[model samples]
Target: MAEITTHQLVKEFPGGVRAVDGLDLTIADGEFFALLGPSGCGKTTLLRTIAGLEAATKGRLTIGDRDVTELPPGKRDVAMVFQDYALFPHMSVADNISYPLKIQRVPKSSRHATAAETADGLALHGLIDRRPGQLSGGQQQRVALARAVASNPTVFLFDEPLSNLDARLRLEARTFLKRLQRDLGVTTVFVTHDQAEALALADRIAIMKEGRIQQIGSPREVFARPANTFVASFVGSTPMNLHTATVSGEHVKVAGSSVPIPPSARSRVSDGDEVIWGARPEYLRWSTEPVEDSIEGSATIVENLGAAALVTVDAGGTLIQLVVDEDDEPEMGARGWVVPRIDRTLLFDGASGELILDDTPTSP
Candidate 1:
């Protein structure tokens, strides 16, 4: 129900460790936004800072329209769900859900009634009297969400809430969480290291690293056009294949092949320049026969992925991966050609590791 905005937000530790460094961001009202990065990448700290659990070292934080930079967690009107689905071990499900309302001094009758209604909505009405120890992991997670919903806060913050669930249950809970957020329409910020989780759940994602944001975009935009090498190497199920190559005319020499510069990077490249060329496995063509501008290599390894397989080929000491139908998976050591898609290929500056996405090159 509220948009969250931060201007020059900073959270630093006593030892000069800057967990979140002068980051500026805005999450739209009722938007599902995610903070994605590797472990120890300040995502949790950032989430905690927004929740008022960790005070900000500098800058401003506003929820909806109020400047809440100096407010306590209780006064911020935000609900947070931690990775472990922190529930009261001794309290019954209904009691746990109604605890926040009780702290607000709501009448016992009214708070219980509200808790019952929220529990029913999350399919936990039947187990309202069960303690946390009696519930399954998935049930505990729902109880945590029910507790947050009972408060009806303007914003929701989640710190890897699905990490405790088993894989199958995680998938189910993911769908459930998405639907829950859509139905309630609360502005939510989720922090996680899982790329798939971020991709599947977020309306927009802020990709972070070392306490700084690297890119912000929709799922498809980040996947198709990564802002830089770090994002290109991190956003996909199988990270994009990135390799160093020397520019020769309009082509880059790599993997024992001369691949044309991608349309997006053509005007940014020149002869004798060293660049990092990249392509996702999903975008490359698989062939047993030789073709134009194709990488020639022998299949070194094949990884089965349900209906498809990731084929790793050794091309003149450089490894290139391509996804092929399970039926078309090549035998080990089979010779083949994997062609990088001309239009979809990516180029990054060799020294800067910055994506060369525009006409103006980054080199001298």
Candidate 2:
């Protein structure tokens, strides 16, 4: 296992468009870290640079204690799993998994033994003789992952390995991948655009935007206390509802209504500072009674998902969403009120969009 580090990493393309810019990261040995962002955000480029598939225009990369910034892909102790599975259709599962060892010219006996062990570990033993075209998508993906690990590389780089699978298959694949990584204890760097996948699998996530990392933290940290508006809006489903507010003493006035600011945000807000109030969907409770932390509104839309319901309430001009018990969904055009779990709400500086107390933890 190895710790991977990158300092001032940068990648520029032919049109002078910078794909990755001034990135600095350190992945502890045996840690599962993820680079998450939208498309065209440079995560893929950074991964390619680390893998030695794409040279960095400016930066230094080190695996464990060795500097590999100038090394070729073959020389780096890293393995990559791509989205396409990339298996040869003509090759059997055993042949596919053993391909890397074959390329390095391992002794035939040792290669076969290692391949069998990996296949068993990945639950691919029964399908070893099947060709890539004959296996299911999940099985094919497992073959790709198994092959990548058969090399025993120090670092495992995953480039959206579950992107092609169906929703249910993705979940299953995620569990398998996480279990495999946990058992192997290999340092891993996963790249994905799916916020849910990143939150569910990564030990720590680096949220990227426009070629730069906006925030890096545990899934809980980024979800409960986002670094900025961009992260707040992007990290969760039904993005944080943002509203302009003015701070006065320990109170913030939003939409002409006064809401007491929690003590956690006290030191971060000045008396006259303009602030933005944000509440996540899960924190907002819909009810007919007036309550502390409650705001009045009219129900505009309701989506009753089997387990829970996502209700949208039009609070004056702002659309506030509440994820409530499925049976409690209010009818459209009904007058209602929303009570936000104060401890779960977020506050940001209006002008900068940065969290008021980014370094501090908030109650979940």
Off by over 4 Å in 1: 359-364
lDDT of 1 by residue, 10-99 (tens): 999999999999999999999999999999889999999999999999999999999999999999999999888889898999999999
**lDDT at position 206, candidate 1:** 95
In candidate 2, which residue pairs get closer than 3 Å at backbone N, Cα or C atoms, i.e. clash? none
The number of the candidate with the highest TM-score is: 1
- Whole-model lDDT, candidate 2? 0.88
TM-score of each: 0.97, 0.96
Give the 10-residue window scoring lowest on summed lDDT in candidate 2: 355-364
What digit string (tens of lDDT, one per residue) describes model 2 on residues 169-210? Answer: 999999998998999999999999999999999999999998
Using lDDT as the measure, the top candidate is 1
